[model samples]
Target chain A: MGINTFNIEEQGFLTTKLSEFIRWAQRNSLWPMPLGISCCAIEMMAFAAPKYDVARFGSEFLRFSPRQSDLLIVAGTVTYKMARVVRKIYDQMPDPKWVIAMGVCTSTGGMYRSYAVVQGIDQFLPVDVYVSGCPPRPENLINGLLKIQELIKKGVPPKRDPIFI
Target chain B: MEEKIDKIVESLGRRNIEAEIRQDPLGTEMILNVGPQHPATHGVLRLVLKLDGEYIVDAVPELGYLHRGKEKIAENMTFLEFLPHTDRMDYLAPLSNNTAYMLAVEKLFGIEAPKRAQYIRVILNELSRISSHLVWLGTFAMDVGALTVFMWCFREREKILSIFDIVTGVRFTTSYARIGGVAQDITDEGIHAIKEFIDNFPKELEQCEKLLNKNRIFIERTDGIGMITKEQAIDIGLSGPNLRASGVPRDLRKDEPYLVYNELDFDIPVYEEGDCLARYYVRLDEMKESVKIVRQCIEKLPSGPVKADEPKATLPKKEKVYTKMEELIHDFILTNFGGTPPVGEVYHAVENPKGELGFYIVSDGTGYPWRLKVRSPSFTNIQELKVRGKGNRRDDMVGRRGSIDTVMGEADK
Candidate 1:
């Protein structure tokens, strides 16, 4: 059940599923843990800046602390050394958290197919959305955030089973 | 952990700080790890600070968290292929990095970019300087508790990025500069946007300056904090505005006069007081200088070909390649095998937004460089933290590091 009827002047009550209410709350307020590692981080900052204004989607609060955030926006190249730190941060974030791989470098290692860079972050952490660009534009990042919101609204659980290191 | 502490102590002994550590009344020297992930460190730069109560006893900057084996990759790829990778190094000022790398390759090839290309390069380089400094100013202001300045800086920065979009077709990683010239000519729209940005930029810059330049809290936080003497700055090899802040007038644009810098009239903003505020002021003044330089370049903009007439070193035009058989063959060879420079070595440095970004390439008369060493300014600039961070209050550490402004990608590379 959702909002069935409404009256401005009269005392009225509306009923909705508890899950629906929770999902709506969760979808609207996905506090991001910005893992701004490189070039994409600039674009990520732009997403949060006055121009793109991620605050409109209710995801403006960029929690540097993983424990306080529900969304992990890994916004650059993830090297092998940094992968451990990334995984640790991902583990620290509470349940129902989603990951947005915000650039080509984080997605399939992009052009940096070196020994140092991790081929893809999905090898260690469960990434929900992949925004593809050498460094994705602010609009592209916003589109990725919207997709994450859509996923939350649909109640799709994040795939937590990462490939064992 | 025990060995690490011992090593630190031994290093401190060399620096003559062992007596102070040994004579401490309260054995409360705690180690603080600032990041490989924290926000203020600015892109995976980790600082391991040894703290005595509220004061930092020593600061050791542990780098390489963002090292993508850039030099190693450069060894494998052709000169043209490696240009895009340069964008990721100093991610904030990609155009400067692009121009720096291209200049190095051009030196090896013994060919200069055309006058038009030189002017365009200068314009882009100065624009990137403004953008990079804006990011640094925003993030640095955030480090010192001035949140409003960050938003204001980014608002101005967005205008610059839109201009980048018009010129280079990419906003963030504009790998626009080619070996002999830029990828394309600056359009009429691009010129118009730049002119508009330069005209309106100063007022926006002044608004930001008003917020932080005289605000009591901002002054209290930055003034007399992270003081590095002129000698210390020189000894530590601090470059860019950081060195200039310490009263060293070693600007590459002024001293070396690369591209059309000699043609343009701009001042080097140097400060004798090498504190955090001095660094801030130098950068602020430098941004205005950058605006002036861009305006001059626009006024002195040439109409000739942007690309140099070097068939062996530069790529053929796409239209010409498609139309003519000879040009198509040249394109195929250039794209696949890349330009072959004579067996030699060349080191070229540009006044990047951060500092002197120098590339040393040793070629074996092949399509690729035998050895490529990136003399990234951040790597050298970060060393001052180890020297200057001692005895400062722990809270001031963020401001100190921000004032220096090291990007991890360049540092680690």
Candidate 2:
């Protein structure tokens, strides 16, 4: 009744294109594979916690299994050693998955311009939305999630560039 | 008999049973890799567990998945520039990290924060401790299969973060503490919020405790599990609640009073059981103790300049920097080069929510520290996993590890 916007009682049936229906379904229920690597992970948890209540956006189900999740929230610093593991997890996730680079750390390496931290996760994985903040507040992260939802609704595929090692 | 024995041996060898029997009489050892990304390890901590059937034979905790080279980065940057980096170390209690690092640097410069500033620091430290313990309680309970407790704990934690927001202007990583003092003074609204939170938080904590404190499943799962002796705890260098839970009444706050801790009257909660449950009780009691401290700090809060009057060691006020020429020059120099401490080393430790967070700074009479070493408690406390995991069931590792409350950022750093 809310997002569906249909009067099935009058028509006695509901009709929609299969692709639109799939997109709608995918847009909702965007189960996040929480790659909570560091401080940003705390904010990511807060997003799921009661105050933020990510449930309203249908992203409350934080799937630990990459195979099942449709969204990957890279929530913290992805170091060089951890990059391989992150890429492996990204690869394991099924097609039509979107990634939300959940902090400045994940988005552009943030304040840590050290030898260990990876510059940005976009080099290794396709990022759908980049949330800015050292560790973005939960609301900021929610805004990022909403942007990802918008992309899904518009039927824009997650952009992927050829990874340079 | 010899012919029969030879035939049995020959048959065993033909089936390859003889080789297996000769290699090991009992074959029950299995290797279990816990994390690096697993939720229970609490951020990028991986444990290699050697298990004999259901029981763990040994555990090897592999660190450094989240090491951003904070100490090395500290050496390169000025003292003031490195403040924010401390926030990421113990991400749960960023305020405590900020306070500890600032205290260390202030010691290096031989300048103490004003009375009001010290009281404010104490209040912030306790608030962060409660928040940190709340997260630990929620996640630890969640690990023990009490999912509702996690929700309830976070609900209370959000209130604390709101208080943090009011006072520090940021929710999570508030680098509020500076080299000689705090970033700014606390507002009336912030004081009001702290008072309100202190009054109401214990009731919410009681509710969370009601959910798990006497619950049979929670008790059975944690009561005698992952036991550590007092001697073992001390030997392994466990500080904070972990050491206190093991019957050692050693707390850096009590033993070596830092900041305004000596002025405040608070009890260090101790439990002799040294199990996961005792650790839980100790933390629960500590949150109550923190509330008491906060109340006392609010009552005894002195009205004076929040930042120290040391011009060389402390940053100039924004108003002074804009209006006065000397202050302007001082601000420029401080921002560009930072304050230069004497050519010496100072080691300062604070009783963080996790444990004893010590910072050792070596000054080459320069703005930047020659070498900065962080003695993070989680790193020392995590060594107990090897000791605790032995003889415990493989599944019990989750509750056991969670009880210790090791934040990998601090541990790996």
Can you write out model 2's per-residue Cα lDDT over B1-413, one digit (the tens) per residue?
44643454453234453443344435455556787879889899888776678888767787888988888899988999999999999999999999999999998999999999999999999999999999999999999989999999899999999999999999989999987779999999999999998989889999998999889989999999999999999899999999999999988888999888999899999999999999999999999999999999999999998998888988899999999999998899899888778999999999999999999998999899999999999999999997667788988999998999989899878
For model 2, report DockQ: 0.80
Residue lDDT tens for model 1, B205-257: 88998888779999999999999999999999999999999999999999998
Model 1 residue B185 CA deviation (Å) reads 0.9
Q: Provide the lowest-lDDT 10-residue window in model 1 chain B.
A: B11-20
lDDT score for residue B270 of model 2: 90
Global lDDT of each candidate: 0.90, 0.89
Docking class of 2: medium
Across A1-165, the per-residue lDDT of candidate 2 in tens digits comes to: 224546587776777778888888988889999999999999999999999999999999998889999899998899998998899898889887889998898988888889999999988788879999988889999999999988888889887756542
RMSD of each: 2.9, 6.0
lDDT of 1 by residue, A96-143 (tens): 789999889899999998999999999888889999988888999999
